[model samples]
Target: MRPPVRLALAAAAASALQIPLQPPNGANVQPVLVESDALADRVGAGNLQKRAEALYEIAELSVDEYGHPTRVIGSRGHLGTINYIKSTLDGLGGYYNLSDQIFSAVSGSVYQAKLVIGDVVPSFTTMGLTPATENKEPVHGDLVLVGDLGCKSSDYPDTAMGSILLIRRGECSFGQKSELAGQAGAVAAVVVNSEQDEIHGTLGAPSPNHVATFGLSGATGGGFIEKLESGEVLDAIAYMDADVDIIETMNIVAQTTHGDPDNCVMLGGHSDSVTEGPGINDDGSGSLSVLEVAVQLSHYKVNNCVRFGWWSGEEEGLLGSNYYVASLSEEENAKLRLFMDYDMMASPNFAYQVYDATDAANPVGSEKLRDLYTAWYEDHGLNYSLIPFDGRSDYDGFIRHGIPAGGIATGAEGVKTEAEEDMFGGRAGEWYDPCYHQLCDDLHNVNLTAWEVNTKASTFALSPFALSTTRSTANAGWV
Candidate 1:
C-alpha cells in the first residue's frame, strides 16, 4: 500500500461509525437497474461515426495485430508494460490515482536449463521460469516415470527421491505439479502433453517465484517412460539459474467523477500477460477498450464517478487489484456503489454472454449488474446468457467486498461455433479471439463490428448507473 492509500483510507473512515458487514447470503438487496436510453444517441451511427479517432486508439490496443504490452515479473517487458500502462492512464487527462503494489518476495530467476535426451522438443510447458537450480553438472539416476504427477500423495507412487520424473499433463495445473514435484523430493521433472498434439495450457497457479519446470510432447515423455518402465537407469545433463530478490510491479488507475463525494463507481482491467504471447485478447482488449471508455466518460463527465484501473501482476495472481481492494476501509468499500470490470471483452469466441450478476431476492451489486447485462442483451435482440462468476478475472476483489460488480468478455480457451459466426458473422471454430495469448493477437485480429458494439454497450453499462448530470465531480460532490 502507498501513503495516499493509508491517508485516503483514514479519511474515508474518519468519524464514520462502523456498520455491520452485510453477508451476500443474508442481504435483502434490490437491483438499482439503470434501464435508460441516455447513451443511445451517443451510441448510434452518428456520434460513433464521429469518434473514429478514439476508436482507432482503442483498436490499436485491443486488436491483435498491433501486439499488446505483455510483461512478466523480473523482466524488461514487465517494466515496459508497467510504464506504458501508467502513461496511457495519464494520457486520459484526469486526476490520476496511481499506486504500486510490491510483491511479498522476489522470486529468483531461472538460468542454465538443459535436457539430456534425443532431440529435446523446442516447445514445452512449465510455470513461468520460476527460481530454479542451474545445476550444470549432469546427475545420473534411475528414471522414474508416471502419468500426470499431481499433488495428491498418491502421485508419488514409490517414486525414487532425487530421480527424474517423466509424466504427462492432465487433471491438475502445471504449477500444482511443479510444487508437488519439489515437495516429492524429485530433483527434476519432465512433463509432456497428455496427447501427441500440443494444446497450450496454464503451467501452474500464478506465481512469479515458484520452481524450475518445463513441458514436452507426448512422444518425448513416452521415450523417457519407456526407458524407465524397462528398468533402464537414465542420466541427463540439466542446467538452470535461479535469482531470488525483490521485483517491482504496479497498478494503473484513472478516474472520472460526478455525484456524492462519499460514493463512487469503479471499473478495472488487468495489464499483465504471460511470456511468449502478448495477451491482446486475454485482457489487452478489455483494458484498452475500458480505457477508451474512461477517456470518453472523462470528456463528458456525469453525476457519478468513474475509476478505471489497469491491474498489474494479474497473470501472476490477482495481485495488483487485490492490493487496492485490501487497502480500502469498510467505509470506502461502502462508498463503492458499483464496480464494472472488463476482461477479454473481444474474445476469440465473441458470444454475447451475460454474466450471472443479479438475483433481486438477495441482490448483490454484481448480481444486479448481471441482470442489467441480461436485459441489455434481450432488449438488443442479441443471443447471450449469463455464466457464473468463476474467479478468473479482476472482479474477484470487488465481489469479495460485497460491492455490486459486473462486466463482459468475448471468450478465451473456448471454441467458437458456426451458429455464433452465422449470428455475429465471424469464422467458426476459431474463437471470438484466436490469438488470445499468442503472438498473433495484433491490430488485424480485432472485429470492427464488435468494437463498435461493445463501445455502445459500455456507454450504457457506465452512464445510466451514474447521474446523467454534467462534468465536474466536485459539483456532484463526488470524489
Candidate 2:
C-alpha cells in the first residue's frame, strides 16, 4: 500500500501529528487536477496522422501468400505493432510500469477454400474457426438446397446426406448452421450472404462438430438454388485447407507510476486486426489514439492510477480481453473504478456516438462517464448520438463483471442514416466505414478530422478520472 499522505512544509509537524513520512516527492506536493479541455487540446490531427502512417508502414512487415498486408495475431506485422508500442512507452523515461502479458490462444487461417458446381468454380471464402476438410482433400457431393435459413436440424433433408448443404445467412450464426448440417450427414456447409455482397464472418469459435464452412456472394448462391429448384442434379466439389493451432501472443498493460494503485482508471483498444487487411480504421486508429494519449499524459501527474491495455485476438474473438479479466484477482478488479473502450475512431463516414450508460444493466457511475463524453462533444459545439451499451468491443469483459464502462466510436459496418449524414455530412445508406474489414482499410482509409476529434473526446473523458477516481478522495482537487 502507498504511504499515508504527507505535507511538504511539515516534516516535524507531520510526525507530531502522527502522519507517515516518505520520499521527498511522495504525497508531499499537491496533486495537479488534469482538466479535460487543456489535456484534450494537446491531441491534434498532425500527430495522429504520423502515428497512423507509422502503423501502416509497420503492417507492411507481414504479408500473406496473396500479397495482402495484415497485422493478425502471431504475424510479423502484429509483432512489430507490439514492439513499437513498448519502445515508445519505454522511451517515456519510466513514467509508467509496463507489463507484457503473454498467453496461448487458438489462431486459424484459411489459405484455400473453393466450391465448384458442375463445370464452374464459384467465388468463395472460408469463415473463421472453420475446420479443414478431412484429409485436407476435395470432397465431392451433390448440391442440396436446405429449406429456410437452415438453422434447424429439420432444415436438412435426408437427401442432404452425402451432399453439400446450401444455407442462407440470416436469423442464426454460421456455427449453428454448420453444426446442424453436420449432424444431418452433410459433408460441408455453404452459407450465402443475405446481402448482394460477399460474406465475411466467423463461425464465432472452433468446434469439431462443424464442417468446412464457406461463404459465397448472394448472387452466386441464388444461381445454384434456382438450378436445384428446377430438379436438376448439380454435382459439387469443395476443397478447403486451413491451419488452426495454438499460438503465443500477448497483451500490453501499462500503468502510471504515480497515483494510488488501489484506485485505477482503465482504457483499452484491441491491437490486432482481421487477416483481410491492415485494419487502420477498424482499430489502428483506436490503438494509436490511446498510445498517443498515454504519451501526452506522461507530461502531467495523476492521482488515481491510469492503465492502458492493447489487447490481442480481438478479431477472432475477445480472447485477449477475456483472458486478461479472468486472470485478475478480486482485489485487482476492485481497484478498477471504471473501464473505457475506444474503437474505429476514424470511420470514413463518421458520426460522433457515445455509449449509452443509462442502460439498466450498466453499473452506477456509468452515466457519469456517458455524461463526460456527451459533455465533451456538447462543450465543443459538436453534435453527437448514443449507441447501444452493447458488448460489441473490448468493453465486453469489464461490463460482464459489473464494472462501469463507457466510450465513443465513430462506427464500423453499421449503416449511416440520413439524420447522421446531415450531422456528419456523409452519404446516407452507406456503411460508416465502407472498407471496414477489407484490404482497402489502409492509411488512406482513415478520416484524420474524425480521428482527431474522437481522440480528443477520449482524452477529455479520461483526464478527470486520472485526477481522482469517483471511488477515492486521495487525489481530489480542482484543476
Candidate 1 has an lDDT of 0.55
As a TM-score, model 2 comes out at 0.86
Candidate 1 C-alpha lDDT tens digits along 69-187: 33344344444445555544555444345555554423223334566654343455444535454343444444567544565646765664676666667776676776666676766
Residue lDDT tens for model 2, 393-454 = 88889878767788999988777899998898898988898897889999889899999999
Instruction: Highest lDDT: give the candidate number.
Output: 2
Poorly placed runs, candidate 2 (over 4 Å)? 1-32, 64-66, 117-124, 147-152, 170-172, 194-198, 217-235, 472-479
Which residue ranges in model 1 land beyond 4 Å of their true spot?
1-70, 73-122, 136-149, 166-173, 190-210, 216-245, 358-363, 418-432, 468-479
**lDDT: worst 10-residue window of model 2:** 17-26
RMSD of 1: 11.0
